[model samples]
Target: MWTAVLLACVGCYLLKLAGMSVPARVLDHPLVERVADLIPVALLAALVAVQVFAAGPGLTVDARAAGLAFAFVALLLRAPFLVVVIGAAAVAAGLRLL
Candidate 1:
């Protein structure tokens, strides 16, 4: 397991290094810039969806779902980031405590 972990880490580092070594002209392309700008948002949404809905390789809805809903509403309302996070945590904790 340790060997596998070390290999994976090395592979990830190499991949990152390869990306960084790509030619500046390639990275400066307009399409690449647009996609790069959007990648973080897409990744974050995917991560949130997985965390809020996945359970042991299956889908489960619970306090996290509710909290995410509240967070979504807060975002739509233009609440501050800190407020959105705190509100979501409060909602999740309140639901779990019930």
Candidate 2:
């Protein structure tokens, strides 16, 4: 497990390095610029989805999902980031307590 973790860390570092090494001309391409702009948002959404719904090898519909739903609503309502986070956590904890 430690070896796998080490390898993964090294691989991630190398991948980042490779991205940094790309020429400015390539990065300046219209398509590349668009993709770069959107990549972080896409990745964040994927990560949030996974964390909210994944349970080991299967998917779950639990308090975390409820929390995420509340968070989404809060975002749509233009709530502050701290409010969004607290609201989500409160919802999840409230649901779990019931």
Candidate 3:
């Protein structure tokens, strides 16, 4: 397990280093900059769609939709991260209990 963890950490660090080491010349290209800008938006859209609409593979909202909405509200209100998480969890629990 320790070896596996070490390997995973090393792999992650290498990926991060590679990301940071991208040459300015490469990233300065207009096409590269455009694509890079879109990448984050695409990723965020995919995440939200997956979390809110997904069902299989243990990713479904099921009875957690209300809680997720509440969490979004908390985020809009600039709540702390812990409060957002706990508020969502509490709402989810309350929903599940019904």
For every candidate, C-alpha RMSD to the true structure in Å: 1.6, 2.3, 5.0
Total backbone collisions, model 1: 0
Off by over 4 Å in 3: 1-23, 29-41, 57-61
Query: Candidate 2 — which residues are off by over 4 angstroms?
Result: 1-14
Model 2 weakest 10-residue run by lDDT: 19-28
- On TM-score, the leading prediction is 1
As a whole number from 0 to 100, the lDDT of residue 69 in candidate 2 is: 94
Tally clashing residue pairs in candidate 2.
0
By the TM-score metric, which is better: model 2 or model 3?
Answer: 2
Worst lDDT run of 10 residues, candidate 3, spans: 55-64
lDDT of each: 0.99, 0.97, 0.87
Q: Model 3 TM-score?
A: 0.56
For lDDT, candidate 2 versus 3, the one ahead is 2
lDDT of 1 by residue, 1-98 (tens): 99999999999999999999999999999999999999999999999999999999899999999999999999999999999999999999999999
Q: Score residue 71 of candidate 3 by CA lDDT.
A: 84
TM-score of each prediction: 0.87, 0.83, 0.56
